[model samples]
Target: MSMVNQTQVHETRLSDAVNRIAPSGIRRFFDLATSMDNVISLGVGEPDYTTPWNVREASIHSLERGLTAYTANAGLIELRRAISTYLTKRFAIDYNPDNEVVVTVGASEGIDLAIRAIVNPGDEVLIVEPCFVSYAPIVSLTGGVPVPVPTEISNDFMVEPEEIVKRITPKTKAIMLSYPNNPTGAVMSRKKMAEVADLVIEHDLTVISDEIYAELSYDDEHVSVPTFPGMWERTILISGFSKSFAMTGWRIGYLCAPEPYASAMLKIHQYAMMCASTMAQYAALEALENGQEMMDEMITSYRQRRNYFVKSLREAGLSCHTPGGAFYAFPSIKETGLTSEEFAEAFLMEERVAVVPGHVFGVGGEGHVRCSYAASMSQLEEVVERLKRFNAARIGR
Candidate 1:
């Protein structure tokens, strides 16, 4: 009779997939770095540069003109048109502005929308290991199972076509590819891309290609996977100004996909976010139209830093590859006799320098750590000295 007269109670029903998803290891290290004073962070994957002055001016202009209302679910006509021209001019891909593009809150939201639009319960989505953290989680949340294909350091982390072919099953619905990749900074060559395109066509699987760091390609020119034959109908090209233009806070990104897919994605976006920020959209349009000069300058700087950091890693006795694109340097920390997490923690505590543990990226990432060189030259020099000191002690032992 204990509480027998009470009203009925109900238990919460959370999806099993939601409960099973792992948190980003990269973010955990970043949080740890923030709590420690005097720490030099190379953990977060963000550009440290200021937003271009011209982009800022555009936003201010929009505000002064009293353009504050919700424009359209698809986005402002002017911005979409600007994106159309920019993509064609830069990547040689064609998309109709009226039906093929949808502005997003960020490439992050674009990813979520893409997953939601295509995935049904229990469908399979192929992903490359040491990929961006959000891809797998977004797939799970959409009730799509993530099938990870591990890339090798010996191969420079480029996905092998045979590996992709081997991983595909009848349930596979889509594949996600990111080049000028985070963590590894590996880029797919044209021949490699052609192989992937052939596979995606053969498998009849959709593709979500994250090319956010497209403009940061150091060794080779960046190309859109969608530009390859047969990929146009099956690919969603995701990019933004955040990494390229140092406009991370602006939070405006866009996706270009074939229609019906684009329309469905826009529906999800309409309900979930309504639209990207009106002010940010204006700034992003300005970025597309006038930010190329700014990009040339930043890319030149990143290339210089990339060269310096790669040499520093080798001189410090760490095993590393020459990254072709992006601002990160992923190097093996195994020789130091510490697990990735142990190496990260000990380095932070003793040297006051923080880097993301590679295991956070996936099984293939063990024994490695990602160091972002997006910081200033002075900061890079300081971190290099700290790493050298750490390596000297390890060698002495």
Candidate 2:
């Protein structure tokens, strides 16, 4: 009788969408590095700097005042107002704080909300390749096809309009863009961005533009997609304080779009997230108001690091394009005759340095590996020494 139990055995069911995507390749290497001792990691893209003291104090003050309750579904009105003001001041874009902005948990959440709001099942979303790894998987989770439009290092990694045009189809719904782009550190020139903008207008497609690294642009003024003619109506702009303000743990990001789209994203935000943290909102408000000097100092440091690191990589016998923005150095490892994953693993094991395999970033990311320059200069100097040794060994082998 004990052996003839009536309960039927059933395997746990998970969403096919969840099953479809692979675990993040960035986190895999980061975790492997964490498990080791005295490892100088260039794997994760996080800023090594801590959040500014004034911003932290603002959050602490909010807690002292007993402001721990949940905010409105759209987030604190004051924070929204600050965000609207900051955008207008910094990027010359306008959004009505009341109805056009929704504060999200992070720029990461803003991406998720924007995709889920607009992407219908079976729709196709064009993703710029060698991008932040989250984009394609998020599109796939919504049952939308993630079509990668690859950019090349030889072309300075700028997206070519003709390539995008080739990928266009009736099922295509929107295009996802990130300039001061992750992994590649490519920033789209305004002239080039305008060309892409023209295509979006001609096709009547929406643009989900993630400008989280907007303030980190080193070569030229960062362009906001919404600033282009006809783009304001169609672009859902996403940005945050993570990279620029060293506020990654605060998780404060926002979405700005037209009323209809904002409302839709708000609906999803209300149900799924309710609201972003109240304390973080206060902290974000302070950052927008008074964190400019500290942010500028961080940017200056990153620029210096970028110059030294890229030069160092090339001198060490790897072909690295000088990044126009962001803190990553994407160098071709193809000369070693090893895949990106193999190189990253072997580099980590032998040299005690950690860099992410570029193939994880989607098409066109292969034959390269992404090394972050966000670590200390001393660490970077050591990384270059080890890289030189590694390259020499590979060449000799």
Candidate 3:
């Protein structure tokens, strides 16, 4: 102060866009669960399984071979070819690895890049909820309006074409979809996906389809929205090795879109990310080549957990729909007469169980909490018992 407050001279102002977004609503429960002993947590969306040995070994071999240098701005052409082949074989979509694919750090980054590259200042992106918490904030960061179109539990929280149709306006530029969805393990059926695809075609809107949980679908075959007739050109298909291969830390994801958008996104990616990690890229290739057996085993386990969790949650007084995919159980906590946040906080503090409040996921998510079964069976069972106790305690039992 005596020196005329020179410290104030370089005070930086953050942009309004950053200021506009709220911190994740799940942070408080997560923080409370941190380092707490005897806490049975279903709060995290991580696969408890480690990455397959073969996949990890490939990365180790790459590092041992000193393949540490950056590959290309769009990533290794060989890796891209693998991705191209994988998508076509798995989801029946075609993309030229040479020009149409860009390896991103994660599907998370691919989502951000897609929106930023195409959305103008005033354009709007319709986000289906309750979704992965990052979608809206990232859209906001790109100066696009984040419009949430809510789905219902009556329909297992699947997004309907009508809900999306009512929200479309002149400013609507794209629609972001994730299925099997996060928070809610709801998958868009092929028929339903086709309906939305038709709507997109009619409106001349782009669709950013995030299929990170593609391999985890349980009851129905996971449909790639881009596979619909006339949908490939307008779909920015995003997927990764994370969920399927238990490769979350590998941070390898990809985008496949038609020209101009692909080229445009690459420009931003080249200047920003340069390329995804070299060793991780190689690991992804290995996952594509040899990890199917491991992925199948993990999916089988997750399906068993899904069956147990849904039945136990309902019997314990929480209403949960049997999720067709992913590993989350989004049960209504409204019967306990507590808000989603209130119930989550109380559950973590009293019963020592952690879960995410659904309200954080966006509109139409209140009155529910998301419990993940991505933990061990013992942990999931114990959490259910704790939630039963929590529900009983609320009623003075």
**TM-score leader:** 2
Least accurate 10 contiguous residues by lDDT in model 1: 4-13
Q: Write candidate 1's Cα lDDT for 50-111 as tens digits.
A: 88898999999999999899989999989999999998988899999999999999899989
Clash tally, candidates in order: 0, 0, 0
Lowest summed lDDT window (length 10), candidate 2: 3-12
Q: Ranking under lDDT, best-scoring first?
A: 2, 1, 3
List pairs with backbone clashes in candidate 3: none
Tens-digit per-residue lDDT, 1-397, candidate 3:
5455553443335577866788877676787798698888788777999998888999999999999999999999998999999988988889999999999999888988998898888899999998999999988888889999999999989898999989999999999999999989998888888888889999999999899999999988899888899988898988888888888888999999997779999999999999999999999999998999988999999999999989998888888888899989999988898999888888888888989998999877899999889889988878877877888966443
Candidate 2 — which residues are off by over 4 angstroms?
Answer: 1-12
Overlapping backbone residue pairs in candidate 2 total 0
* TM value for model 3: 0.96
TM-scores across all candidates? 0.95, 0.97, 0.96
User: What do the candidate models score in CA lDDT, each in turn?
Assistant: 0.90, 0.94, 0.89
RMSD of 1: 3.4
**Global local distance difference test of model 3:** 0.89
Model 3 weakest 10-residue run by lDDT: 3-12
RMSD of each: 3.4, 3.0, 2.5
Candidate 1 Cα misplacement greater than 4 A, ranges: 1-13
Question: Model 1: what TM-score?
Answer: 0.95
Regions of candidate 3 where Cα sits further than 4 Å from its true position: 1-12, 395-397
